[model samples]
Target: MRSLLLALVFALVAPALPAAAGQTLTIAKARALPLGSVVTVGGTVTTPSGAFESSFFDKGFGLQDGTAGIYVSAADDVHATPGRRASVTGTLKDSFGLLILVPTDVSLGRQGLPVFPRWTTTAGVSESTEGRLVLVAGRVTKAPASDLPYGYKFWINDGTGEVQIFVNTQTGIDVSRYHLGQALLVTGFSGQFDTSYEVLPRSPHDILG
Candidate 1:
């Protein structure tokens, strides 16, 4: 009877196990998920080199994506450090009028190759610039120019499309290495800052060959 009871316990528990305990998910997938769903999001969290704030917060934190800002939960203790890739696991919560993943478990991950958005020059992006993260490949229209105290500004244009790019000083990249008219790829959020929409490249690493 002991052996039979043991066998019954194994049979009852075996079906409930998940096939994949830890899997990576893209930001879009994480955002689309329902609240209370368990998921993992992998991304780099860099220290904000300049001052900026988002509507999601009461007092502005020193972290910002370009000049707009970043949205993080007050419950999370993970502060932004430059050039670090973190894998965070938690439940998806829609709070503070934004979709935020409340991280229950956080761990550092091996930094992978930089990911740049794939965008075509032929597409007109000005009107649809709300909350879009895009990657565009093009020839550098201009070299990096000094913006704020801790930022660099440049422009890139494919034959069909063109956009401005911004990188913060904390990325530790030499903007001089990028030559005008050189082929390059950039990834960043597509949105308006200071009444004009622009692509704020999250990091210098986002620029790829």
Candidate 2:
């Protein structure tokens, strides 16, 4: 009887114990972290909203610390609840301003759901026009009223990569649903507007999922 009681007590107590700390590190671990290494870290996410949550930015965190905290955009559906705990995973790429972790995944811990900013207002368009293949996120500006009607054009700016996104109408994308400020992510051919280039959209969907 005593053996059974002890077994029951152990079973009850084991689960209550705190979870073993996973392989985790701080932003300072960037230099030592190897490429393609999966890691977990905790940090404070700054967001448009005033709230903050204990969050996890994973995988690429180690790579970005050397350069700077990863440059994440609100347009990439990566906005986390302010002060919320989260876990993220992605490839680490070094960029000019900050080390960038091209996040593959992000999860908010016990914190409630996050509220993302809506892409509203036409002034969100950015002026940076460099010829390079890249990803941009921003609000859609008004379509040109002029007669040049080959491809659909809209402006996207995510404070990092900003450009005019031209999607071929042949893809059957409905332009009417795109409001002035609807958040959008544009992944396609990127180059200087004056330079010879092409913009091919991966999909026609709302910026916020």
Task: List TM-score per model, in order.
Answer: 0.46, 0.31
lDDT of 1 by residue, 1-209 (tens): 99999999999888554315578666565555567777766665433322122222321111122222222343444444444566667776654334455566767555443333436451343534333446677888888898756467777787776677766555555788788889987766554444444565555566786
Tell how far residue 35 is off in model 1, in angstroms.
Answer: 22
Strongest candidate by TM-score:
1
- Model 1: residues >4 Å from true position, as ranges? 1-77, 80-129
> Each prediction's Cα lDDT score?
0.54, 0.40
Tens digits of lDDT, candidate 2, 23-141: 55554453245555555544443232211111111211111221223333222444454345555555445443233445556655555432232232222322121211234566655
* Model 2 spans > 4 angstroms off: 1-133, 143-148, 160-162, 192-199, 202-209
Worst lDDT run of 10 residues, candidate 2, spans 48-57
